[model samples]
Target chain A: MLKTRIIPCLDVIKNKVVKGVNFKNIKVMGNAVEMARYYSLSGADELCMLDINASYQNRKTFIKTVEAIAKVINIPLTVGGGISVLDDITDLLNAGADKVSINSAAVKNPKLIRQASIKHGSQCIVVAIDGKRHENKMKVVVKGGREITKKELIVWAKEVQSLGAGEILMTSMDTDGVQNGFDSSMLKKVTSNVSIPVIASGGVGNLEHFYLGHLTKSTGLLAASVFHSGKYKIKSVKKYLKNKGVPVRL
Target chain B: MKKKVIGLIDGQSGNIGSINKAIKEIIKGRPYQLKIIKGEFDNSLFSKIILPGQGAYATLISNLKKLKIYKPLKKYLDNNRSYLGICVGMQILSDQGHEDKTTKGLGIIAGEIKKFKSKKLIIPHMGWNSIRLNKEDPIITNNLDNKDFYFVHSYIFQNIKKSNVLANTHYGKKFPSIIKKGNIYGVQFHPEKSHKYGLNLIKNYILKS
Candidate 1:
């Protein structure tokens, strides 16, 4: 049986790991490589680094951060944010990122997903969708959940899969930063529609919430605030899932 | 005493940074240097070799041939001087690959690479899964029993000899996760990306003096 993965998402900005990662083991605190190493040792099945850095000059710096992290840790790294073109994906992969997640750019131009999948096998291409419930209908939103699109979550998910995306990163803006739980309903809708793996993100507050995400169709559970705030440890969540009869790599 | 150099073959199939990191971490204090084998490499230069590859089966095999390392790799494995293959690196060791079209492989093992069938099961059997040891091998799996390792592949070795398989993992049915024939070893999972358990496997391979 495939084990449920516990992923800790780190928000990377200009080579520093910012946004709510408060842990004692963070030796360098803001250092991306140190945080990545700490997460790998903390039993994180995988690490997702969203490069929030937006500058042409800082591109090399972000790649260097990826190189440093790849040198220290032995876990798969999924990088997202600012991936607009095929060259961006190629650059990140060359920098040692195991997988690259494409969000807004994918929605703006679905051809990028197909082109990327062809260039670098679909297994490394992740389509991240930010969905928010509006008028009792879940609509796909982009620009970090600031803008809403007319596309339905399920419809867009199926399209991405057809375009050759290997996995989907479904994040709920409404549940995000709330510390309640993941949008299990939305995740179920997307996962059911697509055969590829779905990673449930946003609003993972406690151990039970992590378990709840497992109960859904998602294969991986991703949370930032809960992990960065030190409210729960990665190992503890893995332990909880393991005890709850959810297959987890301990 | 001269330090042993471990050759990590890079066929330009994909990134090999993680594998390098794992080996470096394992052999920190030891008198061993990790050498990157980008193109044609002499078999006698290194004591052992680690082949890590990704992407399509035909592409990787063709890349090896294009780099003019095909003959050398075959000769090196024929000598049985401790070689480890990860993912497509392992798949290419078979007789042929059935991905897209039937492509010729190294024939190190008498088998064909196949994609997982079954409408119920996912195409690329991704994520962490546990392995059941078929037999004990100190270098292949070491003492790591009943532990799950990260797997991300669409195809697996089929019609393989029973004696050649070292461990089996199940997705829809039991498939070879680890295979060992004398000094030749191949793992379907990426030890470089498997975190601690993966690091352990790499350590076992490097420190198995």
Candidate 2:
């Protein structure tokens, strides 16, 4: 059986890993390689390394970071941030990354998703959508969850899937740092509307949150503060989910 | 003398990082020279060849043929020189693959790769899973006893002759985790991405020669 995935996202700047509240006021966590190795051993299905400074640098550092982590951890690694071109995706894949997550790039040019999927296969491309509940509707955000896009959440997700994205890493910007739990209502709206796998992110403060997140049609769960700051280990989360009758890798 | 090697049948497809990493790890403490050859494969310069892949079975078979290394690879395996395959590389050894559509394989093994269609299970079984040993094969010895290794594929080798199955794993079905006959060894999982147990498995294969 294909178990639901538990992914820990790392926000890397320069060469160090940093975590912040609502994507601001950053604080250094620890060594990127060490953190990645810990997550891999702690039973994380995959790890996402987002180069938060990728747009500013104009050069993708996620690929180099992925290579470093790949040397230690034996799990799938997805590299994102500043992945604007087909060559960027190809370079990361060649550098041992299992998948590439596109956020701002995909929003700017949705065709990149179609092109990448055709050349590298849909399984290798992940379309990450950062959204917020706006005006009674979920809206997409870009530039590391700073700028809002004109497209609606469900509409853009369907378009991206139609364009050949294999999975959706949907994050709720409103509940990102709130720790209230995932926005299940919004998750259900987006996930139920798409046929591809949806990974729910944001507002995960406890095991119950993960349980609820899974029930909302998400194929995977993503967290940072809870998993990174030692609030909870992924093994414990998977165990909890297993006990709750939720299918997870234990 | 340093042993020179050739990776059989290079194409624009397949995961090359895994193959390169496996070879490097295999010869970590040994004396051996390795080279990745493309277009045409001349068997005389290498003592062993590795076939690594991650994609559909038909694409891999077609790519190998297009590169013109398919015949040479077949010839190498017939003469009984060392060869190692990972993931889809292992699937291609079977008589056929049943993904998207039925397609023919390299016919190295007596079985066919079947897709799991149970509504109870999900396609592409991805993550760390345990393997139960059926028989003693050198590639999986010592390290494979009740040990879990990472896996990320959908199809499993079915109807495999008991003589060729080296290891078995239970997902939705009991399937071959490792298959070996003569000089050919096929692993359904990516050993390069599977940590110590996986590294040790590759080391065992290198040590066998």
Best by lDDT: 1
TM-score of chain A of each: 0.94, 0.95
Local accuracy of candidate 1 as per-residue lDDT tens digits, B19-68: 87778877788898889988888989888889988778998888899998
Off by over 4 Å in 1: A20-30, B140-142
Off by over 4 Å in 2: A1-4, A41-43, A56-62, A144-162, A188-196, A214-219, A234-250, B1-10, B98-103, B113-115, B118-121, B143-146, B154-163, B170-175
Q: Model 1, A1-250: lDDT tens per residue?
A: 8988888888876678776422123322367888788888988889999877557787778888888887777788998888888999999999889999999999999999999988888889999999998888999998768798989989999999999998899988888767788988888888788888899998888889998898787999998877776778888888888888998887
lDDT of each structure? Answer: 0.86, 0.80
Q: Show the lowest summed lDDT stretch of 10 residues, model 1 chain A.
A: A20-29
Say which candidate scores most in TM-score. 1
lDDT of 2 by residue, B1-209 (tens): 76656464455564577657667766766777678867676777777777777767777788888888778877777777788878888898888988779988878878998876575553356566778888877777875766767776767889889988878888877888888889898998877776678778877887763
Task: Indicate the residue-level lDDT of B186 in model 2.
Answer: 90
What interface RMSD does every candidate have? 1.1, 3.1
TM-score for each candidate, following the candidate numbering: 0.94, 0.86
